[model samples]
Target: MADTNAQEDFSKLTADLAVLRADVAKLADTLTTLARSQGEAAADAVSSRVRQGKAKAEATASELMDEGRAAYDEARERAGKIGGDVTAVIERNPLGAVAAALGVGFLIGLLSRGR
Candidate 1:
C-alpha cells in the first residue's frame, strides 16, 4: 500500500511540473510578441519625426536663401547708383578729379615709405 501511494504521488507531481512548464513557455511567447510590437512602434515614431525635421530644415534653408538673394539684389542696386553718381561727378570735374587722385597717390606713397 505504501509503494502504491508513493507512485501515485510521483505521477501527480510530474503532471503538475509539465503543466507549469507549458504555462511558462506561453508566457515567454507573449512577452516576446509584446516587445517586438513596442519596438516597431518606437521605430515608426522616430522615422516619422526624422522626416518632419528634414522637411522643416529644408524649408528654413530655402527661406533663408531667398532672403539672402533679396538682400544681395538691394545692395547691388545701391552700389550701382553710388557708382553712377561718382562717375557723373568725375566727368563734370575732370581737373579736380585729377588733382584729388594725385593727392591720394602722394599720401599713399608717403605712408608706404614709413611702413
Candidate 2:
C-alpha cells in the first residue's frame, strides 16, 4: 500500500509540473505580445506628435511671411509718399533746393575731412 500511494503521488506531481510549465510558457507569450503592442503604440504616438508639430511650425512660418510682406508694403508706401513730398518742395523752390544741396555738400565735406 505504501509503494502504491508513493507511486500515485509521484505521478500526480509530474502531471502538475507539466501543467505549470505550460502555463508559464503561455504567460511568457502573452507578455511578449503585450510588450510588442505597447512599443508600436508608443512609436505611433511620437509620429503623430511630430506631424502636429511640423504643421504648427509651418503655419507660424506662413504667418510670419505674411506679416513681413505687409510691413514691406507699408514701408514702400510711406517712402513713396515722402518722395513725392520732397519732389513737390524741390519743384516749388528750385533756387532754394540748389542752395540747400550746396550747403549740405559743404558741411559733409568739412565733417569727412575732420574724420
Candidate 3:
C-alpha cells in the first residue's frame, strides 16, 4: 500500500509538471508577441518623428531661400540706384571724377604694396 501511494504521487507530480511546462510555453508566446508589437510601435513613432523633422527642415530651408531672394532683389535695386547716382555725378564733373579715380588708385596701390 505504501508503494502504491508513492506511485500515485509520482504520477500526479508528472502531470503537474507537464501543465507547468505548457503554461510556460504559452507565457513565452505571449511575451514574444508583446515585444514584437512594442517594437513596431516604437519604430512607427520614430518614423513619424523623422517625418516631422524633415518637414520642418524643408519648411525652414524654403523660408530661408525666400528671404535670400528678397535680399538679392533689394540689393540689386539699391546697386542700380547707386550706379545711376554715380553716373550722374561723373557726368556732372568729369575732371573731378578723374581726379577721384586717380586718388583711389594711389590708395589701392599703397595698400597692396606688401602683397
Top model by lDDT, which number? 3
As for candidate 1, its clashing pairs are none
**Cα-based lDDT at residue 69, candidate 1:** 100
Better of 1 and 2 by lDDT: 2
In TM-score terms, which candidate is top? 3
How would you encode candidate 3's per-residue C-alpha lDDT over 59-89 as one tens digit per residue? 9999999999999999999999999999999
In angstroms, the error of model 3 at 22 is 0.5
Give the poorly placed runs of model 3, Cα more than 4 Å off: none
**What is candidate 1's local distance difference test score?**
0.97
If ranked by lDDT, best first, what sequence of candidates would result?
3, 2, 1
Candidate 2 local lDDT, 1-115, one digit each (tens): 9999999999999999999999999999999999999999999999999999999999999999999999999999999999999999999999999999999999999989954
TM-score of 2: 0.76
Candidate 1 lDDT trough over 10 residues, lowest sum: 106-115
List per-candidate RMSD values in Å.
1.7, 2.6, 1.5
Off-target runs (Cα >4 Å) in candidate 1 are none
Reference-based TM-score, model 1: 0.87
